[model samples]
Target: MIIAKIALELTDLLVCAGVFLVGSVISFFLFHVALRRKREKLISEAEAEAEVLRKEKILQAKEKFFQLKAEHEKYIGEKNNKITQSENR
Candidate 1:
């Protein structure tokens, strides 16, 4: 009778331990998935912001190039006018 009682207690202990182990594994798996998704979202947002900044820089560069081109053309026109007046005189 004592041996039977000991066996029942051991069986109960094994069952409880099994349940606890399964619960821990499931919780860890879910936590890992949640963290990975959060990381991906933050990376996507950062990449989008970087792309927008790059486009803005490109636009500013194009504007500066056009402004410089205009200024250079105006200077050449003034120089040609002066040369023509001197030749005429």
Candidate 2:
């Protein structure tokens, strides 16, 4: 009778342990999936921000180029005017 009781108790313990292990595995899988999704979201946000910054920098560079070109043209015109005045005199 004692041997039978002991065997029954052991069987119950094994079943409980199996259930706990399965639950842990499922929990771990769910956590991993959540983490991956969060990471992807962060990466997407960063890429969008970077694209905006790149476009802004390009616009600023174009503005700078235009300003420099205007200055150069003004300088050349002034020199030409001075030469024409000297020729007239």
TM-scores of the candidates are 0.81, 0.88
**Off by more than 4 A, model 1:** none
lDDT of 2 by residue, 4-73 (tens): 9999999999999999999999999999999999999999999999999999999999999999999999
Report clashes for each candidate as comma-separated counts. 0, 0
Where is model 2 more than 4 Å wrong at Cα? none
RMSD of 2: 1.4
Model 2 TM-score? Answer: 0.88
Query: CA shift at 71, candidate 2, in angstroms?
Result: 1.1
lDDT of each: 0.99, 0.99
Residue-level lDDT for 26 in candidate 2:
100
Highest TM-score: give the candidate number: 2
Superposed by TM-score, candidate 1 places the C-alpha of residue 77 at a distance from the truth, in angstroms, of: 1.7
